[model samples]
Target: MTDSATSVFEADLPTLDYGLTDPPQQIYPQFRAAQQAAPVALGPIGPEILSYEMARTVLRDPRFVIPPGIHLSAHGITSGPLWDRVTRSILNMEGDEHRRLRGLVSRAFTPRATARMHDTIGTVINELIDDATARRSCEFVGDIARPYPIPIICALLGAPREEWQQFSRWAEDIFKIVSFDCDLAAEEPVVLAAWDEFDAYIDTMIAQRRRQLTDDLLSELIRIEDSGDRLNAAEVRMLAFSILLAGTDTTRSQLAASMQVLCEHPEQWALLRDQPELAMRAVEETMRHSPSMCSTVRSAGQDITLGELTFPAGTFIVVNTYAANRDATVYDDPERFDITRAAPPPILTFGGGVHYCLGANLARLELSEALKILAARVPDARCVGEVPWKPLLGLSGPVRLPMELCR
Candidate 1:
């Protein structure tokens, strides 16, 4: 085993800048270089410093644990009142606790259940695109992708439609604070305010639902019973925060990126239009091309050996999904954006193993529905101006994707 003093370990990750001009290309080379030089290395730079990985060792290794405190500290978030609620999330849990909570939440995300939302999801997409058609030109992110997630999530959570925009505002800021690339110093106030507001709003909603339960996920979760036990208020709050944060920003970013890619690759756009049946394929391809999450970190649970290097317990493991998906060894001409490229293996856009994203099905539904509607309505839509892509660490893709709908 390699000793911590002189092992080929790398640290200094938080400060690593893959420059935002064209981040995908900029970061891909660095990740590929890291994979070759040392699968694990010091993070680029930052506090709570640790190592990062760019290989399949993450799946084979069993030493990595998802301890919430370690993960938060890695991002420079110190122990505080806010950290308590933040760490209670499923993403931070492991062992029995993780499995137990994940089981209950998994029920809401099963493929069969998500399939039931197709019609409603399609309706939202059609309405948004229809409105865009009338406008002729709009910022695809703000107008369509951004607004679409609210109604879908609101319906799922039993939140009222009248409060959609308010929730959207809260959801946006709340997720931003937690994202890897967030400027914690600047966004702390906004995030705290958003959480306070979300908590107050949810308390009112929960009280109302208790008085009159409905078919929404929130109401349903309230009534869910397992082994003669039900979820408490704190658990409900954590679940609500997870769903809103997980469901909204990722979906919005993916949808906007899909449109941006389609606009860039008109030939592929023509193919999608010609074969509307390939909407699912298009969604997967878009995810491969422009993933929402750039990376996820796991801590070594024990001394583990992989390749020629050994990771000590408590080491950080970084999985670069964007780089992994684009690895030339994994896919032919990985740089090309081909929706109809002979069915490819499931991409890591949603993740893999026990911690795969719970909202995968919902995201697929939203993307499929969005593309189906957009392709049918504005098949000739094109980029109208410069788009702004956010350099969020954990969350990524375009922030402002302006486009002009075909006349």
Candidate 2:
């Protein structure tokens, strides 16, 4: 790891306090200021890498590796039994271990498999919309966004249908550890308890799968083999933990944020309603405009020089993807939310290189299908009340998006 003291760009940059409930729009100015100042500068938490090119380079660069478990513990977050397994899972892994795990999981989580979920995803969207429409005015997050991804992920994992809500709560609790803006010491106890319960749930599910094999992602993962090597029970449990944690609230946040964007910009909504072909493009635009996960943490594994900045191993770096995606140098009128925006460079919302999100394909499919369904069914829908923002720095989206549907 790069030592922070030796980094060339170690000058103190302006600090911005990110409240868990602060809206993304409120936080953009600070990122823009940092981007204009330097490619890499000190953030309130640590060093920040700002700018699309620099962030992309760092993500793809082998020198910038995922921070180890000790780094997280230093932030006042101690791990539980399940939390320990997940931190050592593929998400935090590096080099050969990451490659092997990624390969094994890819067999079960393929693009083709994601494509097959399109019909099911569409069905879920319509059902949620139907329920919202019947109410005329409903809290969009609770009614649609929150419930939408739960069953889909549960079915994919082969977990019991009744347990989706339980998984959702656990996933939500676990995500608190990732929020740089939150009170980690205060939230630690709840997070630990949630992990214990989640671990027990996953253990029981794994034992059941062992007894009677089912046809789901979990079963496939358990049976998946790479060069005659199979995942152990602990690895399988962690993978399930990863999928549930990565797939649920993150997808829900993205969906809610995209919906909020469309509601705010009715003109864009009208364009999508008229030309449904723009659904996928709109999803891309929303991701670029308001990414669910704004930033990621990395540490320099060895001495490295990026741009004018040089750092020794052990330096902490924050890749500000939110700022990067909206870089003026990369996009014209970078702040505008235009669905018809022409083919631009790929956004860093899903990240880049080896550590890129494994569920990117599935996420894109869900967002595209979600927008298409919304355009077709609720063209006149509009936000009706104060949309509450979740108080988390790592990911930002509305907690309750109240909306009045077309009667």
Candidate 3:
């Protein structure tokens, strides 16, 4: 949005590891305090783009590739099922191969498709709140956040809906690999164990779907695989796993973060309660202000230049959505968390280009609906105890949110 003719060079850059080492609460504030565009190198995490204009440039350009495999390898998770699982995902894919796989399944994630689940999502959240209605208090994370997204995503994939806790646990452990707190080498067992269970679960589901076609995404994938038009059985399995992994805990964290932010802004919470229709814009502000995804990692496939700066090939960098979302150069009052702002510029929370999150529509819908119900039902909800954060910036949210339940 702010396409100023500013130029940046490594010599003048800050040397922070982005949010890796700072206290979670200081991430954005520290970014705002910095005079440089970004760190010369974010320690082992690589360089980052902090300005709104440069972040957009790097993300939309085809030369900056999503390189999960290389990042994981650098962290000592060189090989195993965990490595194989991430490296083969749509997250790590590129070029024609990426397009081919995405084309076959993209229809299921479209806005129209996700919109159909809105009422269903509302039903689930209402039921979740109903279950917690009698309690004097509840751990917001475990009671509400964890169960909220599980059934919706599972139902989307046509998996067993009753296994919400199982999937939640798997997602929690598996997602740690992306968090800065994760001890990759030490976490191999827990992460792989989750993958193994998820793999077997899909194995059985695929077998059943093969016998009878359903109207779900998995059934669609199986049909394509059997047709032998382009997809293979392994691809189908990984694709299913990828969707499940992507949609589950990430959405959970988002809902939790949304609730936390709203807790801090009770007047806005009152507004959402009084006018439920404002849910969408309220959730958008939540994302722009306290996005679950703080940054997106990328690697330059070839030497690339931005204004007066030129970066060599293999340079890993991040589109610092956390920083860019609050760039004073872009928003009139960037630090203000107001939901009623008109025509807010595009947020880089979901990133851009072909690597943009496929489940973004659903995730947004989930959070908005969750907020709608939450505001109506828990209007007086307040955090009664210390709120533990996820220790790292990304996939960022409160680890455990303890809140008083309204009767």
Candidate 4:
């Protein structure tokens, strides 16, 4: 561990600008340099959490809460469909309301619950690979990464399989909010308009589900809504919306990211091809190295102390998860992308604590299944061209991955 006595570790140490907007080539080294210093340092926002322990502490601490609309509101977006949609979503909620929403849908996302999608996820992967295998070369993001997760999520929601394309387009556009590269203000109207279209779409689905009362999650939600104590119409819609946003966007970005990392490491790629059971390990390594959600911010609700630092209420600690995941104290040879790295200390990619990603099990199951299937099917898959990457400051992944799947 680095010394805390240094000026670089000063509590007031000027914002540790990791030069987020710069290319990742420049940004990652900056993170590495900072990790050599003390764990806690001030970032452009507040204190950027660097160490895995510190990050874990901050993320799990009860005093820190994610303030709703802090992302868009910081840029002067206060209200509208975009604001209402985000602020009302289950992801941004807190207290009993948050607890209640989570409780209602918790069973639906458990490991056992998500594992039900394993076969469907594999089937989707095979169909997707079959398409790419025929082309030999395909823009991985568009052809595979972008569209692959939609069907599984759709199946969960009990929606028609054909509706996957429409849902994908809407989810992709709506997902731009999580990426720093997206100009939210410029995208607000467009995103809100899509929300309106989605608003109608989901309403129709809910109505149909209400009438037919299928075994789908949506119908279950309707039953809960009608039960009077469990949920209401708005809550039902919001819960479903939260699942859609969290499920589709993160999985899409992460699958592309997983592929991007595997393609970069030919040896690891081949290793995975030979041992498909390593799919879980490979996905973990990919997430540790190339996470989709770049960082998550937690706002302190009161004064707090961690080791040598104190943060006043309202102070925000941004968990640079990508950096913290590589914290040298926890991971051996942290910089190396090795799927076989034994006992990786629970990668902070999906985060920790109560707000830990609701779709984590599903995401992992999806990625693991995808990795094994792809490795087995396209044994020679590799990055054939430069990847147009998303900003490392937000949801990061290849916007376009030129991949050649040589069988």
Candidate 5:
């Protein structure tokens, strides 16, 4: 932590309004103000926690658990039967159930499994880049970013290639339910319908897999055992849905955001072009600088006190990962986009502790390969239009990125 950064924490903190619709850059000032004031700030939803140390403590502490279903219901957002089933999967589980399910699925995402897909991922990236750059001027999100991740995940799960597009649409609709400023009342019906469709699709796939199992992540998940226990049909369906939900749009948005960042910083692009091994470093910096998922919501399992605030059991806690990643106390000139910065401690872009993102290795593999391929194939690519930002609460990224590729 720098001296100037130390001074920031010493200043009197200001009460800040947590706005869902404001762009992250616009909202960061308030985040800095709140972090300086205290570890946690009272917001409309409940208490919001900033600062790296406090945020990590809240995430790892068992006292802060997954939000209760009723709490989410109060917000007028329901996951319907399918998502309800998914919630029953690892995402909302705790204690023994979470441990069992996570252990079973952990094998599928091990580093070795993820590494085996390197050539496959590179091939997919090249194909997408070929199609995207063939036009010279392209909408990067729709052409490259959006289409890339879905099939890779589908291939990993043994999902039929023909249905990838439909699954992608379903994932997008399901995500709207979780967006910060979403009007739950208006979007609830559509979200429910999408879940129903997704549930039916997954059910059929599960049945098919049972009849003739394949060598894929989904099949492995179905048969995976922990202490001689296996996931049931509903559990398998839910796990598959959870994987699709977490893997698809988030990776797409992150890739798009990273590309936009590189296009804006041509020198960084040149750096990567000159030294391809820095691709992974660039991905990490992009994740640190402009993470797709910004904040995560958790409920206090019991009364807890930390840094001048006492959160009662059931109190809603929002962990501001974006703020923590940019805290100057932790990073020198934290806001500047620098890929060469000394490797700092892991950022909270992926939640830590028991709930650390299960697909993190897969995400890293996809991100690094995406950067490497782009640096090699589209070295001269440049942003061509005003990038439209996605107005989402828990996640941040570009929704539309137009780029011109010079061959």
Candidate 6:
């Protein structure tokens, strides 16, 4: 695979987020318009990257797998801190290993399991609303969106709810790569320290789970028997790490974003308030319109044909989910935020195929609970100030979403 470089592509191309810059909505319209004009655009942001339909092509092509390339290694995306123990979970593994790990986690992330958590999730949502109401105004990202995902994840993993704060801190620090560069000279120590702390936490959990069995995902994974294929200690840690981080960060952002969108479109809020069944549709529509993720990177495994272009093996392809969801061809009046639209299935927010998000069910549950609580309790909640957003291009989320509580 081609290593990320400083100079390889044309300079005329508009440079996108390089771990900096904000206003992705504006950036996206310009980029999508360009891609629609020419599907295969050379990298302007970093190295010789292929964006647009080339992204869809790579995503659809079976030969262009996600692992074993510059995308995975250069990015330092091991399952968890214990790199050796769990080398082949779904997110990082290729071939048989990938399928095997995915199958195990898939069971825990089933529709039934996610559905069952809603009662507890609703309780959490209510508690958050109660807390917000006491304050009259609060930072939704820190107060609500931040805490909502952890307890559900803790419940699923069978971890202690008391330890949720520690997990939250580690997860936040670890994912700050979105805000700060991992490759920076001064960042090495901080990243390494965070990795070490989380790795220790997972190691301790795995060791504890081994001794005392329970119904949590870690214990369930420990009990799994594939005869010839079983998860080792390191693999278990990474799997847990991946699920916790991915599950928490992405959902939290979207949970907060859902509130932002609702606040922006008070009319949509009124419709959902009047008919709560529309909550799910609004969640789906909101995700499609303004997803939490900016883009996902995949390395071209074999020489692949994506539409009109031919990508060589090892090409680092940036799948701009934001662009794909807003494609005028796929979405009618794509720019307009209309939850009432009769949209088709398979929204791109959780992604698609084998790589689809494992916690998508829980995410939906969280959003549903939040909206239900907001509609019932904080119907008059509105943005108190301009939403403070991180400028990182790869992942765009509100750093602080302050909202006023109205009776």
* Most lDDT-accurate candidate: 2
RMSD of 3: 3.7
Backbone clash pairs for candidate 6 read 79-238, 80-238, 85-234, 85-235, 86-234, 86-235
Candidate 5 residue-wise lDDT, 1-407, digit = tens: 23233322233445667565666767788887777667666655666777888899988987788874533475664666534654565778889888778888897778987786687688889999888778877898889888898888877877777888887788778776556556765776787789789888888878888998887787777777767788898888788778887888789889999999988999999999988889888988998888878888888787666645566667777788888888777888888998877777688988988899999999999999999889889999999878878643656788799889996
Instruction: Please provide, for model 2 over 152-265, each residue's C-alpha lDDT reduced to its tens digit, 9 standing for 90 to 100.
Output: 888777777688788878877887766565576677788778877987887888889899888777788888897898988888888887887778878998999999999899
Per-model C-alpha lDDT, please? 0.72, 0.81, 0.77, 0.79, 0.79, 0.68
lDDT of 4 by residue, 97-206 (tens): 77777777775566765776777888898998888899899998888887888899888887788888888788877776665656889998878777667777878888
| Residue-level error in angstroms, candidate 6, position 10 | 11
Which model is ahead, 4 or 6, in terms of lDDT? Answer: 4
Off by over 4 Å in 4: 1-15, 23-25, 179-183, 222-228
List TM-score per model, in order. Answer: 0.86, 0.87, 0.88, 0.90, 0.88, 0.83
Ranking by lDDT: 2, 5, 4, 3, 1, 6
Candidate 6 ranges with C-alpha deviation above 4 Å: 1-20, 46-56, 67-90, 176-213, 226-229
Q: Point out the worst 10-residue segment of candidate 2 by lDDT.
A: 1-10
Runs in model 1 deviating more than 4 A are 2-6, 10-22, 32-62, 67-76, 179-190, 207-212
Q: Tens-digit lDDT track for model 3 on 1-407?
A: 02332223334567554445453566655567652445332433666677887888888898889876765775777777778778878878999888888777775677987887887798899988988777857888899898787788777778766776677778778777665666788888888888888888888888888889897777767665324565666777788777777787778887888898888888988989999999999888988888777788888888777765666677768677777888888877887888888898988888888877888898889998899888998889877788766634446778899888776
- Candidate 6, 240-295: lDDT as tens digits: 77777578777888888778988899998888888888888888888877777766
The pairs that clash in candidate 2 are: 1-313, 1-314, 2-312, 2-313, 2-314, 2-315, 3-313, 20-391, 20-392, 21-391
Clashing pairs in 5: 13-37
User: Cα lDDT for residue 329, model 5?
Assistant: 78
Please identify model 2 stretches exceeding 4 Å from their true place. 1-6, 10-22, 69-75, 78-83, 172-176, 179-214
